[model samples]
Structures are given as C-alpha cells and as structure tokens.
Target: MTVTPRTALTIAGSDSGGGAGVQADLRTFFANGVHGLVALTAVTVQNSLGVQGFSEIPVDVVTAQIKAVAEDMGVDAAKTGMLATAEIIQSVAKTLDEVHIGRTTDTPFVVDPVAASMTGHALLREEALEAIRTELFPRATLITPNLDEVRLLTGVSVTDAASQRTAAEALLEFGSQWVLVKGGHLCDTADCVDLLTDGSAIIELSGPRIDTENTHGGGDTMASAITSSLAKGADVPTAVAEAKRFIERCVMEAYPLGAGVGPVSPFWRLANPR
Candidate 1:
C-alpha cells in the first residue's frame, strides 16, 4: 500500500560535496521515513579539503521558497543551517514567524546554529552572529550546537560537564524550549556525552566515541535526525535521544572520502536492512 510520509523542511545552504548542509539533511529525512523539503539559502564551493567560496541567495527569494513549501505542502518540522548573513537570518526568522512554523507555533523548529565548516572555513559571517542570537534563538523549539558553536553563540567554552550545563543554561535564556549541547568535541572523555536541558530537568545521552576522522557531516546528521523524528511525531526529548542513537551508529560506520575528512554514512541503514 502507498503511504503518505510526514514532511520536514530544511532552510539551509547547499553543500556541493554532498556531505553536509541540505544534502545531508534531505538524506537523513529520507532515511528516517520522512518526506524532505527545502528552501535553499546559499550554495558553497566546497569539498573535503574545505569551503573555498560561496554565494548567498537573495533574501526575497529565500523568503519566497519558505512560504511556498510551508503554504502548499505544510511543514511538520523545520531546521536551519548556514544562513550565511545577518540579512538572511532576519528574513528567514520573519518568514518563519509569518508561516507560524516555529517555537511560538505547534510545529517543531530546530536551529543548528552552523557557524563554520568542519575544516575551519567560516560559513556564517562574523556580523550575522548577533542576528542569529537575537532573532532565531527565541523562535527555536530546539537549538543543537556543537561545543564550538556553543562558545561562538554564548561565549562559554565547554571543557567539561559543568561548563556544558552552564552553556546550555545560557542558551535557554534566549527562549528556546530546549538546548542540546553536543559534547563530541570534548576530547578528554571516552564517551561522547551530550547534555539536554530545558532550564530545569537534565538528561545525559552518551555513546561510545568512535575513533574516526570521517566525521565531516556528523553534526548535520544528528540535527537532521532530530528534525526527522520530530516530523514523525516524537516529542523533543524522545526525538533527541533517538537521534543520538542514530548518529552514533552512523559515526561508527563512517568511511573515508577524500584526502581530508569524510562524511558520516547514512547508507549503513541500507546495508543493515533495518
């Protein structure tokens, strides 16, 4: 029998390398049994070596793409990545508000807060930081930030669990319903521990730290998995826990691509036949 899959939208840039950004998010949505939709914000000239150059889409065009999908197909959940500028961030925030598809609305909204490429090339402009914190954070249902992004957003360098909580609390002050402080960069630990909180209760989700350099798309994969779970009707905490499990497996199955880092493989699901 034919089935109608639940829909999730990604408002982000395109990764020409097929590793991260919209490419990774769409692949994740499909892997998790959700229909994927897009509102492309920018296009990057990148590879495993790094991001070389990029161009942002017009703000009006970005706004229109979001309106088109959210109006006609409907978005059960949505996420943002690599907005590229303060202009795009402000416009995307306004568009999300207009469509009623954010924290203030019933639909779940995820803010990945992408600031740089894995190879240390800046993806978000330096000036866009304030706009993202002030405009997008308040409207986010959940904000998933890697340790580096946490430091960039809140100026809190997370070296351990104590500091991780402090950073998550700081992000909560921005009005997001939940904050996930990803601890994959906490190199001191044997396990990759992510802290989830809503300003009161706290949950620690841990996974074995797979020893691999092919982790290029790891962040995008986890965030997209959460978006996919949210689209499939899971609650925030449940969605996040499920995403943690999904990403750990993807990381373990990661394979090398180019001379530099490679992407987390979602194709493992196909091989395992789950």
Candidate 2:
C-alpha cells in the first residue's frame, strides 16, 4: 500500500541567490512531482545583478557526493550543470560510469553544458570545454544548450532554423543520444523555438516568447523539468515536450526580484493547480 515517489538528481553548483543551479532544479523537480537530490559541484556568490565569486568543490568530494546519493537513494535520472574544471568533468564522467547513471545505461543523464553564468560571468574554466566534449557529452542522454552554449561547444553560431539544425548535428557528433538547441536567445523570432534532434527526427518546441529580462535560471529549470519527467517514466521526447510547456508557463509567471534581473518563477504550478 506504499507508493514510492520518483526521484531525480542534480549534480550542479549552488546559487546563493536561490534562482538558479541546484536551487532552480530542485524547485522544478518539486513542481513536476518528483523528489529532488543534489550533488553540489560549486558554490557561487551571486545575485540578481551577476555572479561575483565562486569556489569549486574538490574533485574527489564531488565524485564522492555523486556516488553516495546515486548508490543509496538510487537515481532514476540525473543532470549536470556548472562543472567548473576539466578534472571535475572527467571525474564526474568516471563516477557516472561507476554508478551506472548515463546514456549508455538505463538511466537518463542530461548534460546542461553550462559554461558561463546568464549574466556572462564564467562559471567554468576555459580548459574544461574540451573535457565536456570528449567525456561528458558522450555519456549524455541529452544535451540542452542555449544558443550561446551551442556556439561555445560547437563553434557553430545558431541564428535561425538552419543554424539550429546545424548546431544540433554538431552536438550529436560528440555522441549524445539527443541534442536540444535552445533558441530562447534568438530574438528575431516571434515565438521562442527550441530545436530538438537525434541526428534524424527533428522536433520543434515553439512557444510565444515572453518578454521579460527576469529569465534567470530558465535553462536549468527546463533541464531539471525534463529530468523530473524522465524520472516519472516519460520518454525523452515526452519529457522534453512536457518540460517545454512547464518552462513556458514558468517564464510567463516570472516576476521581478532584484535590481538587475529576476528569476522565472516555478510557482506557476501552484496557481495552475498542477
């Protein structure tokens, strides 16, 4: 007569402002009806204005945290964000293999490929970029990259539909099972169009672009929503579609917080009553 709640893990940094990173992921997980777990990679001193300073958790500590939660609680799905260095990324990939939580395994693992803060402060080191391509991407069930991250990862500037397709293909070459080239940063379009592909089947998630500067944590919210849906037994396409809808509503409900930029509110779920 006991029902077990679905669970998802976020192997990410901590946002002191509580609008992004594991904070946003946890909120998104809760909103999507899943238990959330975390393996914090770094701690950032940041606010609505921007990131000021940060500290990366030691690689061993990072891996150990992942191992502890994944082995004990059992992760149905997991996602990574703001991995600060090449050493950490490599160690994380190795630990993921040890824990059997990767694309090659049964569990879905999302790679957010976070390189910098939304305000353009670097969250990851320059050297870690290559490690993400060589190590983590290959282990990913899906890679969700904003237009800026797409350019940083693939050196392909995604401007329109054609470029989005190109960027997705480029990401696929790194061996991820699927790629989501997020077009939220593409201002030319009336609707914010995100291109999802697996080197063949292409699906476009298009929604009315909500005009708001308070889009902090937008990407993390979408990624965690996908992970949460995956934990609830949804397929990748279904999970992403549901996440797209979830995030669009979150953006629509976003409210101004600090002086600079506010966060996209996940509280929309409460008002909408699930």
Candidate 3:
C-alpha cells in the first residue's frame, strides 16, 4: 500500500522547559505516529517550577508562520494552545477558517483554552478570552478546557461530574461542535474523570488518579493527542477515548525531571502500551 504519514499542526507557545506548549504538542504527535508541525505564537521563560517571563509573537509574524505551514507542509489535523493575546487568537482563528474552506475539510480544529496555570496564575490575557471564545471557539471541531478554563469561559464553577455536565452544555451554546471538559482540576475526588459531550451524547472517561505533581502540561497533551488521532482518521468519540488512554498512561509513568512539578511523559507508549 502506498500511503503518506498523517500530519498534525500545533499553533501555540514555546516552553523553554521542554515540557508544555510547543514541545509537548510535537512530542505527543510524534509518539502517536503523526508528523508534527508548529506555528509558534509566543516564547516563555519557564521551568518546571513556573513561568518567569513571557513574550508574545507579533501578529504579523504569527500570521506568516501559520500561512507558511499551511501553504506547504499542510495539516491533516491541528490544535491551538496558549494564545497570549487577542490579536494572536484572531489571527489563528481566521487562518484556520481559511484552511478549512479548501482542502482540509474534515480536519479537526482542537482548541485548548489554557487560560490559567495549575497554580491559578493567568497564562492568557483577560482580553484574549473574548477572542478565544467568540472568534476561535465557534470554529473548533473540539474544544478541550480544564475545569478552571471551563469556569473562566462558562461562569459555571464545576465541582463534580454533575456540574461538569452543566458547564459542557453552556460551552456548546457558544458554538463548538464538541466539548471535552477535563475534570483533573476538581478537588473533590481521588479518581480523575473527564466528560466529553456533543449536545446529545455525554461520554465519561475515568481512571484511578495517579498521585503526582508533575502534571503541568496535561491539558495541552490531551488536546494534541486527540488531534493526532483525528489526523489518523479516528472519529471524535474514538479520538477522545484513545487520547484519554494515552494521557493516563503518560501520567502513570511520569517521572520528576526538574526541581518543581514535572510534565506528563507524552512518549510513555514506548515503554508501556495499553
């Protein structure tokens, strides 16, 4: 059989820590057998400990990168994370709109609304939230938001599976085709649970929560892993299911790498497969 490798792209930031953002997405893509590509939107001086400083890529430069990638290398599926400003969000949203208008019809646009850090520090500008929800989110094939980002977008503080359901519906009305509400941030339980909804059906994925603090890039990892599956022709529900399994395995084998919280191992499948 003559076949080309599946390709996926990520429009996000650079993590100097080599754990989250661009680094994490590319790593997850490669591990999942998808060729990875990127259009960086920002640079962050960060370590496993925290982000010390950050700089947004100019809107023109960000626009150029996305155009360059899509024009040539092309994308079968794509995801976005950590757009630091409103301008960057608008640019990414518009570019993807154009990409879908032509050859990439079934390509899934996975948006990971990374509004805040695990420690409650804001990673995105407050002004950018409106751009993400209004400009980019409605165009998304699947929107993955952790509980914190869900509250920021929906104003519904999700504390359990029941509240998670409410938050998903509120997000749906905003126009995304599907919503995957990651419940990793919920403090009420020892088991990690995530909810995926597409108006009519609600799918719940649960696993015994591995006790670990090295989970900094969990949201980005989850979204990109799903994008990788979509690039390889998995349906939305199947992609979500496989990505959930991937993230859980990554967490299971995750080791502490730096002085502070480490990141989940996106390439954990090499050592252990489920």
Candidate 4:
C-alpha cells in the first residue's frame, strides 16, 4: 500500500506557554491529520496568565527559514499568525508573492490577523497592522480577523450580526479573497457567531458559546483548522464550518492550566473521539 503525504505550514510566533501561536497551530494541524511545518517569526514568553516578553526573529532569518522549507519539502497550504513587526510582514509577503507568482497560484493561504492576545498583550504594533493590510491581505486566500482585529483593521466597531456584515464588506474591500470576521467578542448573545465573506456572498457560522477563560489561542487554532482542511481538499464553506465546529469543541473541553486566561485544547477532537 502507498501512503499519501499532506503537508501544511504555519508561519507564526512561538509561545512558551504551549497553548497558542505556532504551538496551537501545529497541534490543530496534527489533530486534523496533516504534517505540520513552521516558520517562526518571534518567540513569546507567555503562560496561561499573560505574555511577559517577546523578541522577533530578524527579517533575513525569517526569510531564510521560509525559503528552506518551501523550496525543499513544499507546502500544500499555509497559515500565518502573530507577525510582530512591519518588516517581518513585508518579508513574508515578498516570499509568498514569489511563491504565488512563480509556482502555485491556487495554494491556500490563511492569514490570522493577530493584533493582540486574549490577555490584552499587544502582539503586533500599529504600524505593523497597516503593513499587513497593505502587503499581505491581498495575497491571502483567507483572512481571519476577530471583532477587535476588525476594529483595528478598519476602524469599524462591530456589535451585532448587521455590524459584522458591514465589517466583512469593508474587510473584503481590503483585497483578501475571503474574510472571516469572528464575533467571539460580541456582547449581545450567549451564542458565538462568525461571518465568512468572499466579496460576493456571506456565510454565517453560529454555535452556543462555551463559557470558559481558556480562549487564548482560539483564533489561531480555528484558522489553522480551516487551512488544514483546505489542504485536505475541502471547499471554503466546508472548511470554515468544520473549523468553527472544531473550535467550539475545543472551547467546551478547555482545561484550566495557566493562572490567567487558559488555553484551548486543540486535541479535543482526538481526546474525545466520537
């Protein structure tokens, strides 16, 4: 019998706490049955409580890491998270452009606009946000931005489903092929709703919100799940729906591990196999 190999890449930061960032992304990928690769943009000192310190890897180093993996092993789909600086974002954007222009234009690229951690720790600076919008958004196959990130990206305050639709439209204008505006921060209901828009149509995913403080890396895990599914040949709506369900399950099964906001268990699917 022959084995088929499916590879996915995560270009993100590392969290020492092991709950979010590259760690969470890799775990999600593994749980979804895909081989995971990483390109570390920064190293974060964080636990369930909060981030203490962070240092970004230099641009050249980041580029080299990306090139080393992409040129040899190859990637079916890729996701990005927590680009700490504008320079790093630009570097990644350039490398991705090279890949998209040269080889695979249909390769899925999921971009998680990680502006801040759940504990209110600043992940990306203000200038870096603009750089991401201008440089990387256009290249991404999908951009996942939470409510706060949507506000930061477009200066539009999202409060309800209507506002979320408005925000999604504005984000679509930013040049991404698809925009997933996560409404986990909305204060209206006990249900969490997220909007996925591809400039032409809108898809709403809603589920009962899990009441837990372990929401630290939910966005990263969700986006990674979608990317992994895409790598496995799922369509956009199917991928987003599966990813949303995966995240909700993770939140429900969240364990208290840190002093502050805990981390979602990306392996919840495997741990509680149906």
CA RMSD, predictions in order = 0.8, 0.9, 1.9, 1.7
Query: After TM-score superposition, what is the CA distance of residue 142 in candidate 3 from its true location, in Å?
Result: 0.5
Q: Write the per-residue lDDT of candidate 3 for residues 1-274, one digit (tens) a residue.
A: 9777889989899989888899999989988988998889889889877888789989888878877878888788888898999988887778787777212367778889888667565679989999988987788889999887888898999987889999999999988889999988886698889999999999998988888888978888999999999999898899999999899988877779889888899877766554
TM-score of each: 0.98, 0.98, 0.95, 0.96
- Give me the displacement of residue 34 in model 4, in angstroms: 0.6
lDDT of each: 0.93, 0.93, 0.86, 0.87
Q: What is the lDDT of residue 154 in candidate 2?
A: 84
Clashes of each: 0, 0, 0, 0
Residues 147-253, candidate 4: write the lDDT tens digits: 88999999899988888999999999878888999988985688999999897788889999888777878899999999899889887889999999899888888
In candidate 2, which residue ranges exceed 4 Å CA deviation? none
Off by over 4 Å in 3: 1-3, 101-104, 272-274
Candidate 4 stretches greater than 4 Å from native = 2-4, 101-104
How many backbone clashes can be found in candidate 3? 0
What tens digits encode model 1's per-residue C-alpha lDDT throughout 117-219? Answer: 9799999999999998999999999999999999998899999999999999999998899999999999989999999999887999998999998998889
Q: Which residue pairs overlap in candidate 4's backbone?
A: none
Global CA lDDT of candidate 4, please?
0.87
Which pairs of residues collide in model 2?
A: none
How high is the lDDT of residue 253 in model 3? 70
Better model by lDDT: candidate 3 vs candidate 4: 4
